[model samples]
Target: MARTGTRSTIGRTPPELWPSGGTLVSTDLLDDGSVDAIAVPLVPAVEGEHGAQPGEGAADVSALYGIDLAEIADRVGLTGASGESYVLQLPRAVGSAVQLPWQALPPRVVLLGLGARSAADLRHAGAALARASRGLGRVLTTAGVQGSQSASQAAQAARAFAEGYLLAAYRPPTSATGPAPAPSAELVLLGRDGTRVTAALDAARTAAAATWLVRDLTTTPSSTKTPAWLADQAKRLAARRGLETQVLTPRELSAQGFGGILAVGAGSASTPRLVVVRYTPTNASGRHVVLVGKGITFDTGGISIKPRESMVTMKTDMAGAAVALATVLAAADSGLAHAVTAVLPLAENHFGASSYRPGDVLRVYGGTTVEVANTDAEGRLVLADALAWADATLEPDVLVDVATLTGAAAVGLGKQRGALFGTDDALVAALERAGEAVGEPLWRLPLVEDYADAVRSDVADLRHVPADAGLGAGAITAALFLREFVGSRRWAHLDIAGPARATSDRHEITEGATGFGARLLLQYLADLR
Candidate 1:
C-alpha cells in the first residue's frame, strides 16, 4: 500500500518501451520528415466570442488540411474544453497529385484543449496528446504555453508541458504489447527558444530523468532488485554524480543496532543494507535536509502473508527508496545550494523460519524497542531505523521520511493524491506548494495527538501497528508510529501509499510506478532558503 491502494513488480524488463528523456526535447525533428504528427494546443473561446484561440504553428498545420483550425473544430464539433482532443486526419491531403514528403501518409494534426491554462491542465493536455500519438516516430507540439507572459510564467508552462510529455509517453517494458500506449522515439516541443524557457525545460527534463530512473528501478522484478542490487544502483549513481555514498552490510547493520531493518529482512536471503548518500555543494545554504526512504524491495507481509492477489504488486514496496535516491541525485544535478543526505534502508519482508513474529520486540536505530504487532506493517519499521539514525547523526535542519506505508492512505485519499503529515506547519505548507507546482498534489492530514495511544505498545516503546483490524485511521496511526523516531526536528512524512503506483493511465501517469516524490522533493529543495 504505497502511493496507491497497492504496490508493484520489476527487473529483467527491457527499457525499450519508453524513452528516458534522453534527447527528448529537440529544436527540430528528423530531416527525413519522421514526424508523424503535430499537436497544437487550443484555448477555449471567450464567454461571448465565437471560437477558441489556436496555438502557435496552427496556421502552418491547418494549411496542410486546406482549411483553418476554427472551421475544422466547428466541422468536427470539437469544443476547446478541458480534456478535449481532436485529431484531424489528413488522408493523403485529399488526393493531391503532388504530395509533400511530410504529407505522404496524410500525417496527423491534433488539437488539445487547455482548461484555464493551469499547470495541471496544460500537463493533462500534453499527456492526452502524447497518448494519442503513441507508436508514432516523432511528434512536435506547439504547447501554446508561450507568448505575452513573463519569463517565469513562460518557464512554468514549458516545464509543465515537458514534464507532462516526458512522463505520459511511457509504457512498461512488457512483452505483451496490446494497446498499452507505446511511446514515441522523440517528442519535440516547438517555440521554446528563449534562454529562460530553455533552462526551465532543461531543468524539468532533468527532473523527469530522475523520475524515469525511479520508475525503472521500482519496475524491475523483485528477484533482480534485492537489497544488494539496490545498494549497487545507489553506488552507481554516486559514482556517476560524484556524490559521497556508503553501503552498510548486514553485519554492520546488526552491529549498529538496526534491529527493525534486520528483523524485517531476516526471512530473505538477500540480506539488508542501508545506503547513505550525501550531496554537499560548495556554497551550501548551511541548512541540511536529511531524507529517509523506506526500501522494502519486496513485501510479502512476513508471517502475516498477504492474499494471493495482494502479493501481485508488492515489488513496488521500494518505490519510496527509489524516489528518495532519485530526488537527491536530481538535487545534485541541479547544483542546489542546500546539503541533502538520503538514507535508504533496504530489505525484503518474507515469511520463513527466521521471520520476525508478532509479540517480538526489537531495538531499532538509536536504541528504541518496538513491538511487532503486524508483520505487514514493515514499512514504518524500516523507516523508523533510518529516521532515528539520521536524527542522531546528520543533524538536519529539516527531516523528511517517505514511504508507501499504509493502504489506509489510499482508503482515505484514493489513488489521486498522497498523504502528507508533519510536525512543522511551515514545512508542510512549503511541501504542499512544491507538490502542487509539480502536479503531484498532497492532502495534509492532522497528526491527531489522540491517535498516539493507538500505536502505544503494552510491552515495548511502540507497536508497529494496532492489533485490531477494525481500528480506523490506519494512516494517522502509521504516521504517529513514525513520529516517535525523529527527535524534536522539523520533520515531515510523505505517505505516498495512495499515489506511488497507478492502477491505470491517468493524466501524465502511466499504469505503473508513478515516481511521485522525486519531482516534489526536487521542487521543494529548489525553493529552500
Candidate 2:
C-alpha cells in the first residue's frame, strides 16, 4: 500500500533534505548528489531488556532471507515499521551511542513512552520532531503504539499529535531571515490495520495547523499587527477558508454605540476594530458556538499607566484575539459540521488627553452603562461591547470568551492551566474534556453570583470593577463583569493570562507566543458531534 516498513522510508524528503545534528541523508550520496538505497537493521526492545538479540522464530526467517542484521534485543518497543537501519525504540529513555542516520527512517521519529502520552506531551514531542525535521529539510513522521482502549480516542490522539507536530514545525516566510527555505510537511500514525487512525490524525492535524496560521498573525508584534492589521488577517483567513469576515472600524463602532471599545481606544494612535468571523459548513447541525476574545494590541493602562519596567511585553494583551481567531480556523480545518462565529474587539489602551476619565459612564452596545472605576481594567470594557454583540447577534447555543484578562488568573492557574468560569455546565465539561484531549489544561471555578452585587454601580448599570472587592478576586470580578453582557446565552469565560505568553524553557522554542488554543479549539470542534 503506502510503502510499509522502515526500508520504504529511505529517501523521502518532503519537509527536509537532511536531519539536524549533522546527520547525513541517503539523498546526498552521489558524486554530483544522487540518491541510493541503504540497508539498516530493525530491532525491537521489550521492557526489562538491555539490547536486541536474535529470537527463536527469527532464526528460520533470518536464515531463509539471509539479511544482514544487528541486535539490541532489549525490550524497547517500536510502534510501526520494521526494516534495515531503523532507529528502534527502547521501552525506557536511554542514551544513544552513535550518530543516527537521517535516511534510515523518516528524518525524525520521537519514541514517546506509554507513561508520557498526554496531548500536551504529544505536542511537545511534535515540536521536538518538527525541529529535527526542519533541520534535516525532510518530511517528518511519527509511529506509536495504539494505547487507548477506545478506537476513537486512539485515532484522535494520533491525528492530534500529527497536527501539533506539523504546526509546531512550520516556519513562516515572514519569520525567515534570508532566502527562505521550503515549508516542511507532516505524517503520523503508521501500522494499525482497519484502524483509519491515519485518516483521523491527518484531518485533525490539518485543522490544527490552520488554526496556527491565524494565531501566529494575532500573536505577532504590535507594531506590525495592530487592530486594523489583525482585521485584515481575519479577512484573508475567512476568504481562504470560505468563511465570512466583517470588520468594523472606530467610526462604525461609535455609530453602532460600542462605547466601551471607543473609550478604550480613544487614547491610542490606532483605532479600535471589531472583527466578526463566521464559519458555516454546508450541512451544519447541532448547537451554534460563539467565541469572544479581547484584542488589546498593547495595554498602557490609559491614565493609570503601567510601570516602565517590562511594559513592552504588554503587546501580548491581544492574546485573547489570537485564541479566538485560532479557534475558528481550527473548526474550519477540522471540517466540523457546525456553525461557529468568533468576535474580537481590538484596541490599544493608552494615555492621552482624549482618554475617558475614571468617572466616565459609557453605554455599551446593549445600552448597559458601566462606570470606569479603574482605567487599567480596560480589557473587560472592550470585551463587554463584543460580548454584548455576540449575544445579541448570534444568540448562540453556547458562547465562550477567552482573554488574557487578569494577572490574578495567572496567579490562580499558573502559566499552563487556565481558569474556566461559566453558567453552562455542559459547555464547561465539554471544554474541559477538549482541554484534556489537547493537553491544554483548563480548570473550572465558581462565578459566585454574590460577587455580581460587588460590581453594581450606584448610577450606571454596573461598575467596571468593584472597589470594595479585594485584589484576591480580580480575575473573578473581571469574568463577572463580562457575564453581565452575556445575557441569557450559555456562556463560559477562559482566563489564559499566564499561559498565553512564556518566559523560557529547555525546548527548541525560546519564548514569545505559546500558540495555545489553536490545537485545543480544533480538537474541541472535531469532537463536538
Candidate 3:
C-alpha cells in the first residue's frame, strides 16, 4: 500500500468549477458581483509617448470603472514598467447598477506591466497577479493587449499565463499547521476568441498539474519516501495510466548483476529498488524512447560524507526520478503514439558498517566494471546499472537519463538551466528545443572524448569519478561515465542539479522542487509522436 494519501488538490481547480471563457464584454457591461478582481496589462512607456494616454486597455479599464486613469497612474507611480503591480479599488457608484448580460466585473482592478511581451514575461505577470489575488475569489483577465497577436501566439501567451498562475497558487504545508487554505481564485480569460483561449487554458492546466505532481513527490520527506515507497507510487501511477510496470527487489538486483546499485545501496537499511514503467501504444511508431532517472532518496555520501550544510536538502537527490515518473504519466495521459519507458533506480546512500567504499569495483549491468573512486558519487553508480539494463533489455532507439548527479553542473550553469550532454546532435537539439519551449532551459556541455581518459581505472574497466581529484569538468566526467553504459546507442544525459530546486520563489518557480525536467521531457515525447 502506498504510505502517503492522495495528493491534496491544493493547486488545482475542480473540473466542474473550472472557469469557462466569458464573453469579451466592454468594461461597462461587467457586474460588480461577477468577479473580485480584474487584471489588465500595462506596457512600459515610450520615451516620447505621453503618459496621459497609457494604452487602449488602460483607457478602456479607466472608462469602464468611471475613474481617471491618468490620475491613478500618476498616483501609483506606474510609469508603464514591467514587473510592476498596483491595485486600485474601484468606486461603487450608488444606484448605478447596470443590467448588462455579460460576466460581472470584480471590485478590484489590477495594473500589471508587460516587460518584454515575451512568454517568460507573461508567465511572471501571471504569477504576480495570482499572488496578489490570493484572498480574492475570482479574477477576470483581459487579453486586449495581446489581441493583435496571432491565434497561436495568443494561445501560447495564455498558456504561459495560466501556468504561472496555477504554479504560484501552490503552497504545500510543511508542519502540523493543518493544510494550507485551498486557493479559491478562479481564472477567467476574456479575449476576442473564447474557443482558442479555452483550449490554451485546458492545455496549460494539464501541464501545470503534471508539474505539481512532480513537485509533491520530490518535496516529500525522504524518510517517508524510501526506495520501496517510490516504487509503490510508481506502480500505482502506472496502473492508473494503463502502463506496464515492473519493480525489481534487492535480491533480484543482485541476481541480475546490478552491482553498481547494490553496492551503493548496501549502506542503507532500506534496500534498493528498480522500477520500469512502459507506455506502448498499439500502433506505436518504432521510435522507442527510454528515460532513466537517478532516484537516490537521500544521499549521506556513505563513508565519504558531505559537509553538514551540503546534506541539508539531500532529499532532493531523487528529483530525476520524480521527473521521469511525471513525464511518463504525462505522456500516457496525452495518448502519444510513441512507445516510452521510464527506468527509475531508487536507493538511499547512507553511511554504515556495510557501506561500499572507495577501491570497490562494481560490475554494472551489461557487465561493465566500474571502480568506485568516491563513494559520494553514488548517483551515477545506480544510474549506470539502470542505463545498461535499459539498453540491453529495451534496446530503445533513444535513451535519455536525468539526474541530480553533480554540484559542478550547478557551478557551471547556475540555477537557471540544466547541463545537457548527448551523443547524438539531433537528440541534443530536440531536447534543447523542448526545454526552451517549456522555459526549462538546457545548456549543452561537451562530452569531450578525451575526458574518457580521466575515468580510466587501473584495476577496473572504468572509474566512477575522475582519476585526479583536482581535475575540472566534474559534470562532463559524470556524463562520460554514464556514456560507457550506453555503448554506441543514441543517448542524452541531463544533469538537472541546477534547475531542479530554487533558493527563492521567482517567476513561475516555487522555492522547493521546481519540477524542472517534467515539461521538457513531455514536450520531447510529444514531438516524437
Give the poorly placed runs of model 3, Cα more than 4 Å off. Answer: 1-34, 50-56, 90-105, 173-177, 181-184, 192-196
lDDT of 1 by residue, 1-529 (tens): 2121111222222122111221213333533576677676777777787666676566665654556777777677666765678877775644557765445333687888877778888788867876777777767776644558786787788778767777876666542333443554366666656677778877877787777778878787787778988888888777888999999999999999999999999998889999999999998756899989999999999998999898898899999999889888988888889999999999999989889998999999988889988899999999999999999999999999989899999999998889999999999999999999998999999999877888888899888888776879999999999999999999999999889999898888878888889999999998987
User: What is the C-alpha lDDT profile of model 3 across 357-472, one tens digit per residue?
Assistant: 99988899988898988999999999999999998889899999999999999999999899999999999999999989888999999988888899899999999898788889
Residue-wise lDDT of candidate 2 within 358-463, one digit each (tens)? 8899999989999999898999999999989888888798888988889898897888888899898887888898888766779888887877787889989999
User: What does the lDDT come to for candidate 1?
Assistant: 0.81
What TM-score, computed on C-alpha atoms, does each candidate reach? 0.89, 0.78, 0.91
- Best-to-worst order by lDDT is 1, 3, 2
Worst 10 residues of 1 by lDDT: 11-20
Q: What order do you get sorting by TM-score, best first?
A: 3, 1, 2
Taken over the whole model, the C-alpha lDDT of each candidate is 0.81, 0.65, 0.80
